[model samples]
Target: MGRIVGIDLGTSTSEIACIVDGTPKLLPNSQGKLVTPSVVHIGEDGGVLVGEAAAEYLFTRPDCTFMEVKRLTGGGEVLKAHGKEYRPEEIQALLLGYLVRCAEESLKEKIERAVITVPAYFTDLQRRATAKAGELAGLAVERILNEPTAAALDYGLANLKECKNVLVYDLGGGTLDVTVLELFEGVIDVKASCGNNHLGGKDFDEIIMGRLAEPSDSADPSADERALMRLKKAAEDCKIALSTREEYQVSLPFLLTGAEGKPLSVEKTVRREDFEDWVAEKVNSTREPMMSALADAALTPGDLQVVLLVGGSTRIPCVKKLVEETLGTVPRSLVDPDLTVARGAAIQAGLIEGSINNEDLVLTDVCPYTLGTAPLQHGIFGRRVFFDPIIPRNTTIPAEKSKIYHPAVDYQTEVTIDVYQGESSDPANNERLGELNLSGIPPAKVGKESVEVSFSYDMNGILQVKASVLSTGRQVSAEISTTGIKAKAPLDLSRWEEAEGARKFRPLIRKAEKLMAAGGDPGGDVELLVRRVKEALLLKNTKEAGDLRDQLLGMLEALEQLLQLQDDRTLGIDRP
Candidate 1:
């Protein structure tokens, strides 16, 4: 019954907005700025500080300040500052609560719910962590909207009747996302999205830090943590200046102490040309996501009517130029890049709250990752495992897909369907979301026992998997969720790099993929060994991993021999 605004909970900055008089407007903070920094601090007295006040402690009290909390959203890392431990979600809550207070003061209404925006490529865990942060702030989260999708909403609201395909290129403070969307006849459908969370303005800041450090002979200015934080601040300022001017001079008084024991004042005059050169690689990296999005949308540069730019990082001149060169089209800035997501979120909140006309505002999104289950089968060596994709990446959200698999062994009475999300053909290379185990299956022949696994991915990115035995009608289900609303503790990834072996075993994987691509296989007995090795690695069994590795390698050599034989046969040449 109260006001529900939209919140763009970003990595480097955060903002809130609401629809007033059928127009979405941003709510400014106490500092009179529409955008608020996402930085958090723990005061000496253990008081929680946020936004501008928190930024004041960045250099002097680097130990008490926390930046880039967004990167820890779904992970299990705690910030120990000022003799206090704070979870990433807790720090975010402080910032969100500040925004809520700002909104309530500006609107003179008690805000209860909000629609928050995150990166399109965020996992279900990450999305839920955002909602948990909102809950910690005492606000009911209306929904978790993707950042690019939110930006598209802001773009679509203006051109409701236009039939055009638009690409959303969002390069923000802490992440970069490219989304392809088509708007026609009051509908906005997201075709594809790709991004890297570790890439953005923050990385550019680091490059600036390195550039500024090149001249320092007194000491490695970045050697001390405090000095590094100070340099980081300087880097940010230098970056903002280079965006508009050909050159900018930065002088930090007493940045470090020289070998002579006197204070070292660092000064550097950076040319925009040089700045762009350092950042050119970072900017170029975004090109991959743009192409990936284009391919996923099944469109070309000529197919797009407009290229929309969103987020503060998009303001950089180099970023703009790179996008134009790659997309072969200039960016269309109908909305402010920095404020677009929050404004779009406000529009979403308004639509949900019935404060604006939204009957024509139909928006459809997609699952950013492939969803499937691990099923076992018989192979030449032994039992083989495969990761069959059920709901593929970029498939429309609020979508459900199912695939049927039969038991591998005769007289099997129980079955387990381990769910995973990724693009890898090998299930072992994917992320395990959850699993469903069903019992009481009718004892039958290997091919006769049938089981169906269904994956339902909603717009919020949560996945619900249901499994059933066809013969006995036995069923089981599980939903992968976080400490959603009531905001409890979170879950930890079993072993983050257990799949590091996947990278080391790339050659073998490629060989298997090539063999499968050739069609009509089964000449080699390697699938079973590969499956065993993957299972062992996934279980973090080092001994088993080593043993399986040996087995897989030997079999791989045989498979390579078999491949050579196939090549000889295809050429109609007699073997030596």
Candidate 2:
């Protein structure tokens, strides 16, 4: 039995840790750095490179180097490198293998098992993909621990005797997760978790990129992969620098060639205030999830004893301010945000392998999403399919719940149990996990034949559904298989045509679009505001859309004035 380790496989970076003398300690990578860039590069010589070494290739060999593959986990999208196609998990496996080898070298012993952490809101397919990546890295995965839960475990281990409600706000490079849990007498019971998988620090970097590239309209810099990579790196640097300083000078010389075949550059001074303004909406977006988590936990902000901050994104001043304002308490970063999740993972590994006593620390988690079957229901519109939740979101894990449903039509001999995962009332609006056909339901009146569906979600977040025909005593079961599943498409908003208030936004939306097309707005502010307005409309959030509409009108006026001023200056006409 080799040693078990803990790993945080993150979007921007990854880390490995282990328990030593009952304390979780991070292990430095091959380069002796505590955190490794989650970047992979395939060399022309057929060798694979990861971490900081591979990060350099991202600039020179952008085609062969891949970063941020974590965002694509569990999707069927294929990544091409060195004339070969690789799945997202395979790319992650390379990073994992590199980390494990480095750890083995440092410890002078083999590590055979690991407890890896993912966002609390990761889906069943994503979890399975992460587990597969671990297996490919040649380790037996002990558990797929939620990142926030792991952070809570790390904190709870050190405060075993305390009884208090805690909240973990984790905003990393590519995701945001808000979790509420209770800690009492060595027990860590999670209440709820909520998050947006598509939001985080990377988004902030993009804001900076847009700001930096605003001055250059002669060419599309994004068309050049190498140029885009350089700009991305510079944007990230600017973001990090502005964290401490009020302003940072972004100087990217010869970034790309202009339409006229001349080298173009990007030189600008980015103020922290401006950056915050640009990202305010995104930062504030975390509020809803935070409030939702607290509500699900049945705890108010005043009830929280401590708020823990995890992930690098929390280092942002605006992000911190938002958390403080929303939670009414300053978040504590006692453990390094960049390192906490991995440390917690290490603690979990310790508990599993007996490095730490199970009696001294116990942890329990919850399902982050709702799981249910779609059954026919009699509604005002006659018979329609509605989602019937078997296990609602935030319910304690390793939980099982069953529901009884009858056949929809008389003499129906079979019933197909369509399982879904989401909160939408319509099954079509949610993700369809899989379906089980329970045949042999002896033909009888619709009300006479009944089928009972059982959903069992485990500690790992995997779902197993079983359907039984009561009278026939026949059964069918299936573990939802998401292997090679295609990535989900963006929410369909085509039905917005018939939405009640959607008509009112068309003229405003059209005006914003025209202003954006006029292309005088430099900071990309006009574009950002317009996109947000459209998003609000898509969500049928009339209130938010209305508010954004007013903002967009004001922004358009300001942009027009700025553009007019620029034209006047270009024409050598000065106005008092």
Candidate 3:
């Protein structure tokens, strides 16, 4: 049988692994290293380079190198490198092909099928994009496993006899994912997963570079592509150094030219304390995801037996402190965080290939996003269509959920089903997955004729939707496409007007009202902002939503403080 290798296709770095001699091991790349830099370079000499060679190419051919292509996966974003344009997934395919070649050379055998890991929060578009990249690279993608889930699988397998609630904190180069998993007997069930794909160690590197680079409205011609690339490399090196050292010296000689046309230089010695202070806000951004995961699982930090740290970013001393403070425990650092995902992928590959006989290692995943359809709702502003989630986020995979939707008009014999993925009360506010058309339904009065729509999300992340007429047993079904393009636009639901505000944020508004009822004085300002933010999000005004969210968050913080003080007074205890 052909090998079903496990691949950790990452934004900043990638690794391939396979089970050998009853154990999972990372395969060394052509550079004889386990961690391959996810960098590709189209050479000036009409050649191609990947990994270490490609990463370093930035020093001389900055415009020719492509790094972090994983960020653009399924985003419909485009890139240009070395005067040649490429889709994000195409770049990924090139890198995957390189890794496959390395694996083939190491094993002295062909590898066809493989399991690839992605962020759990990856949308249908992103998930399918990763799988398609694998196919473009000439490998049959066996499974698309979540990165945190893969790591948990590896950890769970190692401690098979023990039961634990393990929280997986994965902060890699370009994203942050926090997942809570229940490991019982031999079954591993993911309770919850949440993350921000735009945040990670790369942000820290950019922060450091910003400190060294001069800010100006005009271009610093002296700091050309090469110079900027040099600064980036230097920032990354210093970041790694500060992980173990108290301080690191950064020096860039002949880095650029000043406006005066003189050769400029950059030299700075950054202290570990200073870096930690500057990056504190970025560190704090990760807390929401952790809290969200715990909330989804109905768990507290105290409920977690141990926190498992994964990804290279966790090596930062300050990051560890943040996790310990938030989770109320010293996180387990024994596992090789950077390689865990790939190694676990190898373990999964083994299972798929029948190379491993551990049938007790039962695994279950959940739909990372809400599955819903647009439905009519009566509101204060009259009738409007809102997002109606049939299956909410965090629901276990291989699970089924159904909801009855009724016709909006009398004697309506035709209906169009628009499926979306998100947890928004407003339909247009979420990602539209696909749409379906059903006809020949028995006509009746408004809200009288109905159909039961069921969403069955399997472990593979594919969604099977079945619509059955209540008057008749007539049924129609459609599957969410892995390519994500199956969802056609101009959904024919445009006539469904939206009031927008006071929809999704209704819960927050009520919570604020409760606090006020309990003697917390948020005033009308908090309520006003909530209403405004909802309108902003509905209007697709993200800038306004962002500003309002900050204001709302601050008001909530103050209200919480008031509640805390009230509790303290009630207990006759001093405020600490």
Candidate 4:
């Protein structure tokens, strides 16, 4: 059997890594590219292509291609692209299939199990959706590891320390996760975690691009779209450039159409100083939140042994500086900022498969948000709690916690229990998950009766909610149903199956001969790129994976289209 893989299924790009022999090794795709684009193409022939090939051909063949499908996750709404609406699961599946195939090729065998990682703050449904994606991709998911927890494992292995308090600041492509972990005697204990699903490195890139790109007030819509796309692309290029260079320039082009509908062009330039000055405020905004987390844990920055950084965004010089300035110390850089979680996850997968023993290693994870229910008096007074959390944020998971409540009125036969998952006291300010109806309650005087409400978040990040009427001893327990978010409109996948049926699997092989023939190694960051592709491939819910695959592909296709013209060009350019 092929070895189980560890995946960092990122928002912008995904990665994969696995334990081979006694050391962890990264895997590359057929293109020999380290990180495969988390993209999927719906070909004109009704076939599907995932990874670099799909991404490369997206802009060159936009009519049938779909990309950036991950945005549709938890959307509960169908997305329209290439004249068809796709469900999230289907999109994710395609990406997973591509990854599994890549792994099979590498090991020259079948792989059936894996340890997949998710954002620390992903909701119950999102977690389920992720696991379902894995199932669709044809692997038995051994476990779902939190991204920060995985990073901690990596840290633990490298340090081999006796005990210490380490904070993991995981800033990924689409989300920001801050976790406080206590590492001691082979056990990794999670104290707390906080995150925002809407925030991450992508937001940073967009903010930089949005500020630098010039607006076009042209009458042609298509021209406007193409121009704006270039502007954003230019913004992204500048952001990447600034990461490595002291300064970078973005040229804003003005396309002027002649009388015969031909075009003329003009250019303007933007420097790194102007770019930094514009984004400084955005960069500083994260400080207060980081401080708040420390405050909650009752620990000053000086209390930490290390402020370990994870995620590709940490590559930004400004980010690193800001974090150091905030903490008053230089943070540790033991793992590659982008590949930390992927490697940690791979290490854990190895232990689970007995390739690496758990005799001296243990890991713990925490909840990222608060979980609770509506106040007893508020509902009686016509007050509604939206996302009142029963479980407070950062509580350790796979551990049980509970709170008690009393009856609000006399002679009440049925009680309404509105459950929520967030930190705000006001329900309207939080996310209203669902409510429970506790029936058959014995009629009682006001404040004469009570119920014990319990919440349990498991290692997989799934929540189990329960309520027991103390007086009657009646109880109910359930894994909270996350049907609150509507499912996406289902797309017919028959065409995809038919296409696969007709095609023979063309495997990617890189023997010594092939590598030597390639003239040299694949290039810089080849290992990092390979790891990203493997991580993305291990994500398997067919529908969601398929959708994410489509979205990522679409994004890459858009970029490829902009990058296709072979000319003297810098990475960052403002097109519009």
CA shift of 329, model 1, Å: 2.6
Write the residue-wise lDDT of candidate 2 on 1-576 in tens digits. Answer: 878999999999999999999999999999999999999999888799999999988989999999999999887799997789999999999999999999999999998799999999988888888999999999899999999999999999889899989999999999999999999998999999999989989999998888789645788877899989999999999899988899999899999888768989888998999999999999999999999999999999999988999999998988999999998964464868999899999999999899999999998899998999899998788998899999999999999999999999876866778889998998999988877877655556668767889999998888888887675345677778765323223333345446567788777667766766777654455655655555556667778778877887887788778888889999999998
The sequence of per-residue lDDT tens digits that candidate 4 reaches over residues 387-496 is 44566777767768887877666656456666677677777666656666665454556666677888788878777777776754556566666464222222222233
Off by over 4 Å in 4: 1-3, 61-68, 219-229, 251-266, 378-389, 471-473, 484-576
Best by lDDT: 2
* lDDT string, candidate 3, 411-439, tens digits: 67678888898877887788887777776
Each model's lDDT: 0.82, 0.87, 0.82, 0.67
| TM-score of every prediction relative to native | 0.79, 0.83, 0.80, 0.76
Model 3 residue 557 lDDT score: 89
Choose the strongest candidate by TM-score.
2
Better of 2 and 3 by lDDT: 2
The reply for model 3, stretches above 4 Å from the true place, is: 44-46, 217-223, 411-414, 437-444, 466-477, 481-576
Q: Residue 102 deviation, candidate 4, in Å?
A: 0.9
RMSD of each: 14.8, 24.3, 19.1, 26.4
Mind sharing the TM-score for model 4? 0.76
